[model samples]
Target: MPQTNGNAPGRCAPIPKTIPPMKDLTTENITENVIALNNLCSDPRTRYLFERLVHHLHDFARETQLTSEEWMSGINFLTAVGQISDDLRAEMILLSDTMGLSLLMDAIAHPRVPKATEGTVLGPFHTHDAPVTDNGYVLHDDPGAEQLFVLCNIKDTEEQPLENVQCDVWEGDSHGFYDVQKGADRQGPDGRAVLRSNSEGVFYFTAVVPVPYPIPDDGPVGGMLKLLNRHPNRPGHIHFMLETPGYDKLVTALYPRGDPYETSDPVFGVKESLIVDLSLVDEAVADKYGVKVGMKLLTYDFVLASDEQAAELRKDRRKEAAAKLDVDISTLHLD
Candidate 1:
């Protein structure tokens, strides 16, 4: 046997000439392998989604030459994001909004719905079964700066009135805090109310104009924003969830005039059609709606989609109610 430099007889042999060199395995080869694996998905939807995802993800990896450490860090960030969510919070949705994905999806999925009110993100704060107040009750039970008066109308695209349309509305206070967030009143849902549109397809309410405020920054999404040197603030807006038996339901927000972030909302939820100038009304005109003079009035009409979609939307409302009850019971020890 041939003697090796430091091995005994029969322990050494020439390396195989047919073996491929490890150095030939490059990033491009790895990316190609990932693409091939993605194509192996059999489910049509899964295959379609994963194929696109793999292509983009590989392209991103190549573009950035992302290291294993960087990839692991991203995985860790997503893990923490999921860890921070609870019954009352949706951290991932907030992350999506801040990243502009939510707005894009809303725009694509909602389309114009053809004369129906454009839908926007149902921000993470909606609570179910708000007190059913009369058409003119104040949403904000307490007084605050920037008086707000809202006149809402519900109708078909053809301008036919939708009687008994349910409108569920809520908003932050002048200080940008929802009633429940402030723990102001435990007996009822705070900063939230549901009212029905009258025979004229009209509903009115009084409240202080909500102040623009930042989304919660105590979570992973907040950390990312800080890293990106971006503010978490969303513009001043009122939340609305409306539906009628004969039209499509709408979930949207109304942007106030002169909010600093109106045009550049952090969540990208603003729509040009939704922005309305809240004009200062004469006291007499306000009093006609049971509001004081000098109150700021904002008016908008909601055009519902087709009747079939409206029924589905109403069913969603019921499902939302049940889900909320489960959340309350699990978190607050309440019925």
Candidate 2:
């Protein structure tokens, strides 16, 4: 049999005859030549993305006049980022969020719908197996933390109630620690739940008011943030993810209006339109949501986009992106 490689006792096969010769590399010609290496990629989307990526990378290296030492340092930092990440934590996502790329991609992919809800970044801590709970459920009841009741109303773009929508509610506790962040000995779900909307398109649950929390700062991303003179803290916000059969799934968070870090969330996840007005309630109002006499109440509404509407929006955004690259929209992948 003809050998394809040096597999048996140092016997080697000859090089393929079909390979093309590469031009001698220089700063001026390397970018185009590097892109040309992928000219045979079967996937159009991969080819399109990689061509632009290589162009920008070359430009960046030239613009900064990057040193070999600096490049090595970057490689070491990325290696550490991968080394320290496992099932529980996501250092890559942390790096992206701190650099604002995550939110930028989110904005491009989820361009605003005319009357539908807005979405923010899906942070790394979202868990899939949060316990299912009914409406009027109490998500938390810790004596050390002030009480909070969350009321959510779901509707369609035409203002029609959407029944049976899946709404996931999750947040860190008063101390800004999620259940998974607590490590292996955690007992059960803390400050998170899976819920379905009732017939009226409403769900009410008792939870503690989320406190502002810093993203994990012990990893490479944290060190990078410090070097950049930035803080890793995000504003106090409760996450909500809504899903239904015929509508676009919404992944969003509602930030309370008065958090100190609202103006400077490091991850760039907050939006002015998503900020909700929080109210302090007396015993009479608190009694309704089963909270303490002096607690907080948060009520927010959502409007979902239909599958067709969301698809159209995505197509339009891809067209805009393709236009910027001077590529045919038909050649660009929609998702």
Candidate 3:
């Protein structure tokens, strides 16, 4: 037996080396390691979100035992989605809408907003500024279908009327193509308008009854549709974005008369409250609205949410515009 002294370096006892068990390095262990990596993030919100995302993503991978080949395929799909994007298109947002994520998020964020008209996804084609028109003007730039008059009113949740509100409207022609999509040089508010409500809270516009048409399926989103055996069509509807000083803005669409896809809008934007009945009437009613006689008339009411909610709705539009520009919004210092 060798004598050992605690104070002398040469006689000191051997130091104990403890190693973590190998079983602790399973998939769950790797997940915990990934979460720990989030400590390197300086932004609190980013760190919190990335940590949770890693946990769930790792859990999902482990549960499915996802293979490397499958993971690489997903990466390729995403890469194609990004490569397909250009100045006039947004494949990622379209993908989200087609998968119903956009609608689900909208439902959660805009819960039970009273007097506030239901909000829907604004598709990727909204022009920054539509041509400003007066109370009763036509928005149809290229003609293809029968004329229809849209008479709408803006009111608060209490049913009290609101005036001086801004209403932006846009829709495709009977042929199912927006003016912007028609040609590269043909982009200048061709089929869009921004109108102000009258003193009676009424806004009137004349246009052809839009026909149900397929969304652009010539890109990656289209490939997804082909794979899923789904059509990229949306119902015939007129888009509306209304805003007032003290009320929530309403982003919605009004389905046309007897649209085939009304029940199966690809974007899940159809709302029972937003549907309008286009009654075929004699020329008398049409003449009063400065519209052609014998054309159908669709009348609907737009109820706005509170002021705070309206602001939030507008914020979404601003974000969309910023994304299209592909610039760092924080650096822009925009008002």
* TM-score winner: 2
Tens-place lDDT per residue, model 2, 1-335, is 22233333456665433334565799898987788666557787788889889999889999999999999999999999999998778989988887889999887767788988899988988888788988777776466987687878899989998888998988888888888787787687778888999899988788888889999998899999999999889998898899989888898999989899999999999998899998876787567656666568898889998988888989988888788978978667775
Candidate with better lDDT, 1 vs 2: 2
Q: In model 1, what lDDT does residue 121 have? A: 85
Error of 1 at 226 (Å): 1.4
Runs in model 3 deviating more than 4 A are: 1-26, 183-187, 281-288, 308-335
Task: Give the per-residue lDDT of model 1 (tens digit) for 123-207.
Answer: 8788875888889877765654676888878888778888888899998878887655543245566678999998898998887
- Per-prediction CA RMSD (Å): 12.8, 3.5, 10.9
Q: What lDDT does model 1 reach? A: 0.76
TM-score of each: 0.75, 0.91, 0.79
Residue 24 accuracy (lDDT) in model 1: 49
Most accurate candidate by lDDT: 2
Over 4 Å off, model 2: 1-17, 281-294
Report how far off residue 282 is in candidate 3 (Å): 5.6
lDDT string for model 3 (1-335, tens) is 22233343786665233222233567758876666556456665576668668878988899899999989978898899899877667788888889888887776555546556787878877877688889778887665677777888888878878888999998888687787686577757666899999889999888778888888898878888898899788988888888766665567788864678888888888887777778764677666666666677888888877866645654665466559867454432323
What is candidate 3's local distance difference test score? 0.76
> Considering TM-score, which of the candidate structures 1 and 2 is the better prediction for this target?
2
